[model samples]
Target: MNTLNQGSQKYDVAYLKQTIIPGKTTKGQITQMFGAPTNEELNSTSTSNESNWTYEKTDEGLDKYMKLAHKYVSTETSLKMYETSAQLAKAQTVANDVSSVTGTKTGQSQTQGSVLTIYFVDDVVKYYRVY
Candidate 1:
């Protein structure tokens, strides 16, 4: 009998929700933890003086032509630092309380877990964890 173990590795909720953080952490530290980032950007000159990084991961699984049975998971994490140290602590707090969920399917039925982490510094979402 064929088992799911032998199936190809595909992107799924399990792989997307792995980037969540719960404490004081910086973009540099997160990069070290998850390797190179997928994208990076800085806030507008009018906005805070800080940079953001986005890390993305994707995988393909099973073939369901009925409605496209490929799994794709992407996560974008952003971290920013201000001119004052006071903002640093708040930024870290906002980056630690993020959660999200995303998925797609067609004819057949697939039960996929939807879990996302939204990092917040000072109680605001800064980074996002999506699988």
Candidate 2:
């Protein structure tokens, strides 16, 4: 399978939620754990010196389609390699099932990911959210 990255890093949201605590975790500590952010920006709309750091991972192309194609091809090939009637019958059944499933259409969602953003102020985490 292929992977597409929209930013500099990827993150396990569950781990982040459990580890990173607002008003507790320091910016230095966050960097030590998750590495550099995809972007660093000051929250212009806010009067305080609040900053936002973003970490994002996005979908890869053709992964779903390739998996479906591989399933169908492998099942059909197994039908030819089987020497016994029972094996062949099983292979045929598998092949039939695989054949009926269609690949994803264009513009269909292949995978899903959420951007993990940490908001900081005074070099400490103020709050965090996934967008």
Candidate 3:
């Protein structure tokens, strides 16, 4: 498939909302919840002096290309590949299952990534935004 860039690991919006709460969540909690952020800024905005912790993952919708790739790969699972026959076959089967719609539908834009920016003042979460 044609991928622009793999970018960072995926983030779940629901998980973030459920775990993090502004005014109550602490920096340690945020860090523990999502691990080290993708980036950090001393002063993210001119108007605010609060430290901004950013966790981001970007994807430009791979549904179409992924579908095409799935269609192509499904037809090749039986064929012998570079990897060991057992390993290759198993890998191919799993890949096909994800796009086969029996498991995960990778050809959906809803599998998009997220960018979470949490503004901190005195180690407590002042505000947060997830895009």
TM-score of 3: 0.46
lDDT of 3 by residue, 13-127 (tens): 5555567778899989877666677688786555545788887553223433444555567456524332344696698777777767765655333433467788898778988
Candidate 2's TM-score reads 0.48
Q: Candidate 1: give its CA RMSD in angstroms.
A: 19.0
lDDT of 2 by residue, 79-122 (tens): 55444546866886776566556542322121223677889997
Report the CA-based lDDT of candidate 3 relative to the real structure: 0.62
Preferred candidate (TM-score higher): 2 or 3:
2
Superposition error at 127 for model 2 (Å): 1.3
Better of 1 and 2 by TM-score: 2
Candidate 1 lDDT by residue in tens digits, 13-53: 44334444444555555545555444655555624444555
Sorted by TM-score (best first), the order is 2, 3, 1
Worst 10 residues of 2 by lDDT: 104-113
Candidate lDDT values, in order:
0.38, 0.63, 0.62
Q: Which 10 successive residues of model 3 have the least lDDT summed?
A: 1-10
User: Per-candidate TM vs. native?
Assistant: 0.32, 0.48, 0.46
Cα miss at 1, model 1 (Å)? Answer: 21
What lDDT is reached at residue 57 by model 3? 51
Residue 31 shift from truth in candidate 1, angstroms: 1.5
lDDT of 2 at 34: 69
